[model samples]
Each structure stands twice: as structure tokens, then as C-alpha cells.
Target: MNSEARNQHVGKVTHHELKQTLGTWQLWGIAVGLVISGEYFGWSYGWASAGTLGFVITAVFIAAMYTTFIFSFTELTTSIPHAGGPFAYARHAFGPTGGYLAGAATLVEFVFAPPAIALAIGAYLHVQFPGLEPKHAAMGAYLVFMALNIVGVQIAAAFELCVTLLAIFELLVFMGVVSPGFQWTNFTKGGWSGADTFSMGSFHGMFAAIPFAIWFFLAIEGVAMAAEEAKNPKRSIPIAYVTGILTLVVLAIGVMVFAGAAGDWTKLSNINDPLPQAMKFIVGEHSGWMHMLVWLGLFGLVASFHGIILGYSRQIFALARAGFLPEWLAKVHPRFKTPHRAILAGGVVGIAAIYSDELIQFGGQTLTANIVTMSVFGAIVMYIISMLALFKLRRSDPNMERPFRAPLFPFFPAFALVAAVICLATMAYFNFLVAIVFAIFLALGYVYFLLTRHQRETAPTDALLEE
Candidate 1:
């Protein structure tokens, strides 16, 4: 065979397939776990930007976008059912360049998100144990979760379900505990997005609050990453995505609203531990309920952190398999049948990100907030590309067997696309520095992608046949 033909063939690669151990419920666990952290924190930052009433409007709009996006995105997930998620969808709909863009964006969203969650995990731990260092705790979390993921998908999903359930229960408990203190007036205090009324300032705060509202549902699409390992993805993915989005919408609104009502919402608006802080206002800082929230709340953060590890690993494996990344990173564990190297690779990056607080600075924002915005930037980009792929595929591959067609057809996807564009523009406008850094990150990856094309093109199709 010619060198070009040789590069396109594969013969020695072991089957890179993951075991089909995920069911509808496990998929739901993953779907919920991937975003439950948003309920615990992050969204409150919107309040700081827009005020309680302003963030309220922003959250409702964001929730609508996510609702529409998930309904449409399910079509891609079930139709393609690939580990690469958006990358695979874009590749099938467009081509290699599209695949490269989606894959690179997925890496940014999945990889960067975990570090922010990890730091939150560390800070949560610090509240209970003043002796433990937050950074060390963050690094330790990466080690533990990465090991769990590398061991097996079933093990990882099960843990995700348990933590996710606990996390959900804790949110419910929080709303209930603080219910008596909830005053409608408190929610509207200094209302209109941060000002007393809707003004130029409110408009600015409203747009600036977009990313924080997005944080509420940011990584939920990551469920698409685990689609391949799902049992009967057509059926399970539909159930998981639909139910999961609804579950999250309720929790996000409830948590945000109740947290606002229980105390001075402004106090919770800018902090990482908003729930705990809000609870303390009602139950007293030294109260047992406040203490429980601080501890059990860790489950919410853990769920997202752990779930994203699973997500980023799968994206790495998929990109590697398609020769977008180093092919060796595609290997499935011989015994565990998991993407071991991919998991570890993402872990190292996340750990480094967790420690880069002093080494890197951007736009005078806290490292965690900046990281959250960075993750949101990647997610919105991926969302726009995924929706474009949906539109293109409907025309290009009309006969493709779609198990779950997006309801409302063009309308749903169109709404998602518009919302995503608004989000990306607003985020970049407000966070010019972080946006530049994010663009630089993607550009560097694209350069490496271009330089490595020859080797990747030459990779053997050895693993494809096994699959």
C-alpha cells in the first residue's frame, strides 16, 4: 500500500470499545451528576452581576435555552451514539475540520470544569478541617476520582449515581430548611439585574450574568459523551436527557430562589459556598443544619467533578481513536475495559489547573470564577457547532436513522443556536481577557493538530475492525 493508504489503515490496535454497562438510570446519574454542581454554587455569581431579580430573569432565559438545546441535542446523541459526543456529530455532519473544532472545544469544556469543581471541593473540605490545605485537597480529589474512572465505567457510574442522589436530596433539604425564612421581597431586593430598575446598568449586568446562569446547566450535555457505553442508547439517552434536564431545571431554580430568599441574596451572590452561607443565615453559622450542608454539599461538587472526569476521558479517547490526538491515548484498559490513559491524561491537566492560581491571572477575577467562564466559553462554542451540525445533517443525511428526533424540528435548534450565539457574544464582550486566553488555547491546539496530521492519518484501522 502507498504511505497514504498505510496511514488510513489499522491492524495492531486493540478494540478501544468500552463495555456497555450504563443503563437509563446510570445515564441519568451521569447526566445529573455532570451539572448538579451548578446548583451548589457558581450560579450565585449571576446575582452579583445582575442582582437577585436580574439573575432571576437571566436564569429563566438560560433555563429555556438549555431546555431547547437538550431536546435538540438528543437527536444527535441518539442518531450517532459515539463517544466523541459533539465531535462525532460535527464530523458526520461536516468533516475533519469540524471534528477538530468540536473535539478541541469538548476538551476545553470538560478538562477545565473539573479544576474549578475540585477547588470548590477543597474549599468545602477546608470549612470542616482547617488543617487541610485546599490545593492539596484539590489534587487529592483528582487522584481519587481519576483512579475510580480508570477502574471501570460501571464502578464510576454507580458512584456518580449515589453521590448525585445525595446531592439532590441535600438541595431539597436546603429549600425545606430555609423555606420559613423565604420572603418574596427578599428575592427582589435591589432588583432589576442589580440596579433598582431596568436601566443601562441592568442591561450590562443582564448580559454579563449570562455565563453564571449558564453555569447552572453548563456540563449537562456531557451526557452525550457517555452515549456509547449506554445500553440501547436510543431508548436510554432519550429518557436520561429528557428527565435529567427537567430534574436540573427544577433544582437549579429552586436552589437559586430559596438561597436568595433565606438571606441577603447579595451575600451569596459572589461566593463559592453560597448554599452553606445562605443556610447559615437561617440556621445560624454554628447550627447543625448549616454544618450538614457544608459537608453533604460536597456530594454536589463531587458528582460534577467525578462525572466530568468520565466525560473528558471519553472525549480524549474518542479524539485519539479518530487520530485527532495521539493514538496511544486511545487504548482501553486490558482488564478494566476503560480508557485508562485518557483518564490519567485529563487528570494531570486538571491538577495543574487546580494549582495554577498564582501562576496565571486574568481580568482581576477570582481563579475559580475565571475558570468557570473559561469552561462556559468552550461549552457555548460547542453548543453552537453542535446545533449547526444538527441543521446540516438534517439536510445532508436525511435518511439517517434517528431514534429520537428533536421535537419542533428547526425551531428547537434555531432557539438553541440563537441563545448560544448571544451567550458567546455576551461572555466574550464582558470577559475580553478570558475570551482571548480561551482563543489562544484553542489556536495552540489547532497548530498541534495540524502538525500531527501526517502521523494521525497514517494510524492503522486495527481498532476499528475490533469495534
Candidate 2:
């Protein structure tokens, strides 16, 4: 047997085998990038589009929901210490088909976000060299990161650690310079007049913001993919999930409120790049430091791409082993033990998406919107099925071993399921047409699953059953 297969338990994984592979510090680096996704999504939502107070409120709600969901997933991960993170968990709980769908949805999350990140990277590179070509920059960013991932997990983890640390430091530096200028008066003064009818002060205004808030808080599970590589995952996974979300929430609220209060909200509407604009306006001409902050923050785009590639390569590897994707995509490099083929395949898709976006006219109603909304659709669907798996496994496989058990059993599982359903309802309300598009993707995945089943390989035991 291979070393990995031998290291795993005879019948089930035990706590003893859960030793660290890369290093605790490197693992921590990956978690930091995962947690800071809140900041990335915050920029995408744009303070100008959502207003300051409203954005802070959304951040708070998302943090709480995210914390709860990840904590529950940690329980699932520890219970079944397998290579496939969510895909394995789903199979253990539900069945083969559910596992297939969960894996497919997550693959979409990892595969599709590359273009957006690449485009953002291009935008930053454009700033330093105004005449630089965007497509070439985007393609280069994608290719370099793909090559980095192909090298090995340890190398990718180190790169992620460095960029994540720089990104955090830059954010802190910019916040420090602009923090003193915060004026509480800006929040209430000249708020919501004429064409913009949303009021920050009214209860009705807060209620209307939930849909936007849901969009802002998506993608917290981006960290769950690290389960296999983590040391003492049972303990570490829960802590990282909670800690990461809390850190982002506090920082996001602080930056949004302080920046808004320090300057004028109307000024936000006029700025194309909100972070640098807010920093410059608050810090005045002393704002040369803000330019440095922009470059560092831009490095975050690179860091995020690295984390996503590492995370998704594992997902692709897991699905391939389970007979969903082609066998070739499942191959691990002999020296690196990383999914080299999957990484290259993912790079191709990411590069293509980047080119496609550049060639097409992207607006509010376009593939960008479709891809982003579909990620939410994937998350919600994955959440519901996984939750059900939690409850079902507890009953059907009561004798199965579990290292970490979710608190309150059926209740927490039920809570996660209901909360996800509510978020889906919110998505439907805000954009039914977008909901329809997401539904189409899920249907297509299911159809693909149906066509591939007849040709799938069977374990020796399954063949015995047929005989």
C-alpha cells in the first residue's frame, strides 16, 4: 500500500494519525487568507453601492452566520477524516449522488472565481504602469500562480503566508492614517435624499438591507478545503473558522465606519477605487503612504488566487478519486504529492475566464453576475445537503466513530439547514432571474452525473453484490 493509504487507520481514522504535514505556521497562513475573504468581498460590494452604515451591519450578520456554519462543518470534518472534504462528508452522510453534486458545486466555486481575481490583479498592475496591457497581466498572474501550485503544497503555503501578512499590514497602515479624521456627523448628515430613498436611521432601511448583506457575507467555507492538510483538524478547524470570520468582521466594520465618518459619503460615489480614495481624502496630501497601501492591498488579490488554487486542486482531486471527474485529473505528482494535473486544468479555465471577460462587455447583468450568484447557489445547496447528512448519518450510522460532535446534535444541523434556506429565499427575492440562472447550472450538473454513471468503476464488493 502507498504510504498515505497505510498511514490511514485500518478501518477508521484515529486522533493519533493526525500529525502535521507542512507546518502549523504555514497552515495558519492559509487560514488568514480564507478569513480575510470578507475584506475582498467588501470591496466588490463597494461602499458606494451599499452605503457605510448598511455595509457595517451586513458584515456583522455575515460574521455570525459564517461562524456558526464553519463550526458545524468542523464537526463533520473531524468525524470523517478523509481526503475529500465536503464531498467525502456528503457521501458518508447522504450517498454517492449527493457527494457528486456537492463536489461539482464546490469545483465551480474554486474554478469560476479566478477570472474575477485575475481582473482585479490586472487593475492593480494597471495603477503602477498605466500603459500596461490588462489581458497580458491577467494571463501572467494566472500562469505564475498555476505554476506555483504545481510545484507543491509547501511552496504554495509559504507564498500565501507572505502575501497574507503583507495584505494585513497594509490594511492596518491605511486604517491608522485615516482613523483620526472620522466624523460621526457624516453618517447622519445629508443621508438619503431625492433619487436614493434608502434611510440608515429607519427600521425599514435595515430590513431592506438583508438581501445586500447576504451577498456581502458569502464564501466563508473557503477555509474548509484545508481540512486534510491541517494538523489536529478537530481542534484547529473550528478555531480557525471562528477566529478568521471574527477578525474580518471587526476590521471591516472599523474601516467602513471610520472611513465614512472621516469623510463624506457622497465622496465615495465619485471614487472608482474606494479604499485609496477614502484613505487619501482622510489623510490629505500626506496620502503618498496611501499609494503604498494600494499596492500591498493589490498583493492580496495575488494571495487570494493562490489560496483558491490550492483549495480547489484538492476538491478536484477528491472528485476524481470518487469517479466523478476523469482519472487523469486525479493524478498526484510523485515528489510533490499535489494534484498537478488538476492544477493545470484549473489554470486553463481561470485563464479562459479572464480572456472571456476582457473580450466581452461585462455589466451588472452579465457572466460576472451569473458566476458570483451561482457561488451563492452552490453554497446554499451544499449547506442544506451537508446539514441533512449530519442528521441522517447520526441516525443510520449511529455506531460509526466520531472524533468531534456538533453541539446540540439535530438542532444545530436543523438550524444550519433553515438558515441556508432563508438565505436562498433572500437571493430569490432580490433577483429571481439570477436565481433561475443558478438553477440551470445545478440541473446541468445533475444531467452530467446521470450520463456518466453507467461507465463508472465499481469497488470489488459492489461487483460481488451484482454476481
Judging by TM-score against the true structure, name the best candidate: 1
Whole-model Cα lDDT of every candidate shown, in order: 0.88, 0.64
Off by over 4 Å in 2: 1-20, 35-37, 40-50, 190-218, 269-272, 358-367, 408-413, 459-467
TM-score of each prediction: 0.96, 0.84
- Model 2 per-residue lDDT tens digits across residues 1-467: 44554344222212112124545556556766643543544342434444555545554655556556666776777676555667777876667787877877777767766666677678678877889887689888888888898787777888888987887777677678877776787754544331234554533333334444544345556556666667666666666655665666666666566666767666764333566777777666456786677767776677777888887777786676555777567677766667788888888887776666543333354545555555566667777777777778788878766667777666666667777777667667665776776667678878877877743442111111111
lDDT of 1 by residue, 266-337 (tens): 888767888888888788988988878877988999999999999999999999988889988989999999
TM-score of 2: 0.84
Model 1 misplaced stretches (Cα beyond 4 Å): 1-13, 460-467
Residue-level lDDT for 191 in candidate 2? 43
